[model samples]
Target: MEHEATRITGTDLDPEAAFQRRLGAVVQAVEERIAALLDDAPRRGEIARPARLVAAMRHAMLGGGKRLRPFLVIETAALFGVPFAHALNGACALELVHGYSLVHDDLPAMDDDDLRRGRPTVHKAFDEATAILAGDALLTLAFDVAADESSHTDPAVRAAFVQGLARAAGLGGMVGGQMIDLAAEGRYGDVLLDEARVRRLQAMKTGALIAFAVDAGALLGRAPLGDRQALGAYGRAVGAAFQIADDILDRESSAAAMGKRTDKDAGKGKATLVGVLGLERARRERDTLVEAAIAALASFGAKADILRSAARFTASRQS
Candidate 1:
């Protein structure tokens, strides 16, 4: 045990397996917490709404997925010795935002998909209006969850969490990237959306929330400003790699595996690194970004191996 604590090494079989198992547990824990919160929240006015709206929101929120964003929030907090229960309380907010985004994204006005997490999309399961309302409700609930005082001991910490969530899920982040994505359609052959633009769009669309997830942990734990900043940078890098992996999967994987439509980006003629650069080049870029993400954790020494494993997993994941 002493040797284990003092050992210094990169990600190996044991750590990788441990990381996967931990991620699985964190995903389950976050899902359970979010469900319970949704169930009990209306009594507290945390999120009160019609039963139909609540059901739609529940449909969109609780389903099968990686829950990677929540994983980041909890594990990063653990790096600073924050208890999993405390970190989980705040991390659920990010997952709500993510679920909201997915629900709306699959609407006829957006990505227009009919499946999510291997089930009928909210819009398809109910109606378009219900799906829209569910997304709006979830987004509102996310801020409420972030600001809840019970999640943290300090008011300032709760404020930071709320503010961070706003920025990451706001116009400058996910929403803005989505606008770029919708606008970039069919501009594949044009210079309107170059590589840089696409990457920025990717950063905003996917990376911002991820960076916020990792940063949320540090904020709740009151980690040093310097370490928090480093983790933010790490999150951005890992987020990029994660998107690139998605691009790869879209090109190669089946819709059954992803539980949603595949090749949609290419079909839309959207700008992607895989479409801009070739597959090999995108793979190289993803690898490079993963290394950068890992490098950003150097400040944490051997203790950061879990994060390193996460970055590698982002680049290598099949779905």
Candidate 2:
């Protein structure tokens, strides 16, 4: 199975099956890493770990979605011949930040979501304060893991990971984009969401971290400047397509199908390409981005077919 799974040739087996096999491996590894990170035992320089806090953090991190961000890190690192073991912790760190974002995103003051991954959200399953703390802890733990020597041998690479992730999650990136999204909802005042503004919001909110995920792999392997730029392009294209696909899913998918509320984007007046470009055009744009993402990998040749498939899956994913 290991031999079969590592091979990415199109004719060797079913493409979707192979892609899913690789993805499942990443999800399993990330889940195990997260569980270990949230364990009851305190690490060096930490006080006693609180049981409830650990449980809340565990609930927010474990048994969740596709873990696509981690997959991108691991897979892209492999493109540069970096072993998965070397990349695993960094991948886990990125996913930890993603989990933290979702926990906070589902808060009463934010999207106010009740269900996530078909289960009660952190705030719903636990308490709001606990949920908030869990998010904070998860975000902090991400930096911990990224800073650890296990993530990379070079201090420079680890430092880059820390700085890059902070930038991706900080004011100029996901958090700022979230603020813009909320303001666009008329939470503060009237904010016109033209196509340009909508695209910018999505790029910052969703694209930044995703682009970081791919770039982290390049950093991990210390890839050349040109290769790094190529992966960056791929990540940006996929990231944009991802948000467009999400908006389309919100409009067209059922709550039961999505494991969360649907039809809420329009109701909240959230800035989305689907809202600005209409469903048909949004879909066309997504397809175009998928192609562009693939084209960005042209320099990597057959080694990047898995990534090419990933771009397709991102655009066409039902959930």
Which window of 10 residues has the lowest lDDT sum in candidate 1?
1-10
Considering only N, C-alpha and C atoms within 3 Å, which residue pairs clash in candidate 1? none
What clash count goes with each model? 0, 0
User: Number of clashing pairs, model 2?
Assistant: 0
Per TM-score, the best of the predicted structures is 2
Error (Å) of candidate 1 at residue 102 is 0.3
Candidate 1 off by > 4 Å:
1-13, 46-48, 186-191
In angstroms, the error of model 1 at 20 is: 1.1
Best by lDDT: 2
Candidates' C-alpha lDDT: 0.86, 0.90
Cα lDDT of model 2 by residue, 1-319, tens digit: 2433245444565656667778877778788778888899999999899999999999988988878899999899988888877899999999999999999999999999999989999999999999999999999999999999999999999999899999998899999999999999998988898888888899989999999999999999999999999999999999999889999999999988898999999888888998888899999999999999999999998778888889999987888
TM-score per candidate, in order?
Answer: 0.92, 0.96
In angstroms, what RMSD does candidate 2 have relative to the true structure?
A: 1.8
